[model samples]
Target: MSYLRISDTVVETYRIVHYEQTNFLNRLHGGDMLFFLVETGMLSATKVAKGTSLLASLDDVVFKKPVKLGDIIRVRAETVYIGNTSLEVEINAFNQNEEVVSAYATYVKVDDLLRPVPVGVKIVEENEEEKRKIEEIKKRRESKLSKIADRQKMRFRTEDITEGIRYKISNVIHVSPELTYDGKIMSAGKLLKLMDDIGGVVCFNYIGYNNSTDYTSGAVVTVAVKGLTFYSPIRLNDIITIRAGLIYVGNTSADVIINVIREDMKGLKEHVATAYFTYVRIDKEGKPIKMPKYIPVTDREKNLYEEALLRRGLRK
Candidate 1:
């Protein structure tokens, strides 16, 4: 319906990674960086759509290097492609001259009732990267939509079988009104922050527990988020539970699958979101180190292990 230039939809912002943004390890928190990215991308998309938009899905987000305190992060977002009612945005985070993170996200135009509506806009490609991303936008959007369908069948078992190298972390928290937008709906960035923290702890416990006998020591850092899908929006005061565990462990890396569920009025648990985060074991010098071997014990574990390998191969 409406045509717009990519330049007109671009948004750039600056952030100083201060002490509050840093983790206990003194490195910039990945969650904070992602929050910045999401905010910038959403702003840009809203400008192009000329109305509110909902983030449908997040593409492959890879964190190349750690953002340190006192570092200034330059975030840039641009609309790369537009569909009938959705658009793709490419976001990048830079620390000085080095690119620290890169991501692509899909957002859908929504009406006042929060229903999908036509964006009525077109993105004007201004570079080779933009052209290349445009060609794959449709495929990515399709894949994201498929994930939405898959979420209905997604399940996270709470089996506490400790017969193998497995770790599980669960937390139930109340979604306070202060953490939400419009005083009802939870912020996607806040959810991402929780996911990152839970996923990181899962990785940490996996490494610490598996290698305790060998006295192996190292730090775990999030390298990439493969696919994170939000099936439902969280509401204020809702009690939500997050469960995360390691599905596959490689030489110096591991893949963690996290599921978020909320309790309905009938006391039934409903799936809210699922995310896969890849973390690398890093030594004191920040180099990747070998991780403990993970042996699958159950049929479900075996299936998940194989699936994780397939996902890793795709990334390669």
Candidate 2:
């Protein structure tokens, strides 16, 4: 097998946070940051894989600091590990010198037919530092795999929403050409932005803001995202069904779970991706405000509530 140096797979890009990329509070949107990270990660992976790379899973994404408008954000991504058919990328975004966002994403190398293919190249460590970093990456991957196995055993159906403050909404959108990178499969970054948009809508609806006239009530801003996994790829012209539901609420924060389902022309539907987004309610001054508490009335609600609590604890 051929070997490629880790430096050969490094990709870096910079962009100024535009006005359109900011939220209502004039801060960089979390989803936009995710888009940039995924884009950079894919570029780095493709350099080593020698073909298309599809995002398979992302985890441990934490927003450390809020990026303001006009701030120049620099993102750096590099392939840290090479598996048989998959690779892991570590991406970091910084404002000047301080790190603001960090994420690890796994991508599967795919051929023209979109089938997983073995990566023909392996990463060559240049020094002890690179070797140590790869070891850490392996450890993290193993831990994540164990957690996924445990979560699968739980098998809690997220579609079951019964009473209480479980505000839910569904939106449909046609996957346009602009959303795809290879003119066929949709870009994961665009799908993430759509998910975050629907998630914010669900949070606002739960807090009693249903229309434009309710703007004076309050605003919701995303703080963090946890365990975003893409089980299948979305294709071009596919009808995407995005479902968002309020799962748990705290003093000033709430957890919204968004599920994306794709339907082809022939009417076959598949669950594409699912993630838990944490948002905080803020007033006109952008200060945290008290949100209405959520009470679990059904078994499903309780289960989801407990799971959210677990995720929250893990975040801490």
Candidate 3:
């Protein structure tokens, strides 16, 4: 079996410039972009791994650029290294101008049951079809993110206000599922799961880690729901955008800002929910690890921690 073959997977594309994707600055939110990138990476890896990995863990990521509406966004995934039981994959996101918006990610290999398989077991029987798929993914990588490039595109309802006070990233990041909420949104454990997903996305998509790695996610050292706000009740069909961005990096923990936005404006542009979370980075044994600098927010993100703590403290 050939040890390596370049591949390409065009996961998703959109001209969507909905307010739900922007933050208080009215620009595309970082947290939501992270979520989308990670989810897409997982899908691509599953296709290559034949559904053997359960997305065991993620490391870290840095956002190099921003993506806006009318900029055809494209995501590509490819295998860089593969082990008997895990694989290292790199993911890249591009804007219409073909500039890299984000990079890097890693994925672990799982077995037929979606559980982590043994650390060193062959996962796939290579074939020509797999090679072709890899090539297709590569073709996209060499091309521009927006094929329509310089062509003029339709401006949206909020196009004129790119500099306006933006909608906080609630809509892009923290999407309450269309299903009921028996406190799933507020559950500390559930919130931790969201944190994992967030980190996984960063490491796998932005930092170029692959799904076939051997590392596993650790435990939570700190999970503070800094603050949460609701404009109106969120219901079905409203795209739940769960967005997150880095706040502070410690030797072993990092703070993240998360938000969930729905069409709850009641037909207006009102933010629905927001949160500030601090998670401890840990190893497979669940021990805290150090993290360096990461992506930062562009809007007013000052002393929001103390504010979130106050809100989380006052029980309803």
Q: For this target, which candidate reaches the highest lDDT against the unseen true structure?
A: 2
**Candidate 1 C-alpha RMSD relative to the actual structure:** 3.7
Q: What is the C-alpha lDDT of each candidate?
A: 0.79, 0.85, 0.44
- Candidate 2 per-residue lDDT, tens place, 131-210, comes to 99999999988887776674443333334232343488888999989999968999999899888888998888888875
Total clashes for model 2: 0
Each prediction's total of clashing residue pairs, residues at least 3 apart in sequence or on different chains, is 1, 0, 48
Q: Give the higher-lDDT candidate: 2 or 3.
A: 2
Clashing pairs in 2: none
lDDT of 1 by residue, 1-316 (tens): 6677777888999999889878545788777887888888888888899888777678699998898889999999988888888878989999887899999987778886777898877776678976777777767777777656655455333233222435778788888887786787677778878888888888888777444434357878888886876666677778888888788889998888877887655566666777788888877666799987889887768878888878878544
Off by over 4 Å in 1: 126-129, 146-165, 209-216, 264-269, 314-316
- The local distance difference test score of model 3 is 0.44
Question: Candidate 1 overall Cα lDDT vs. reference?
Answer: 0.79
Top model number, TM-score: 2
lDDT of 3 by residue, 145-192 (tens): 243242223111212111221222222433455242332222222333
TM-score of each: 0.87, 0.90, 0.40
RMSD of each: 3.7, 3.1, 19.4
On the 0 to 100 scale, the lDDT of residue 255 in model 3 is 57
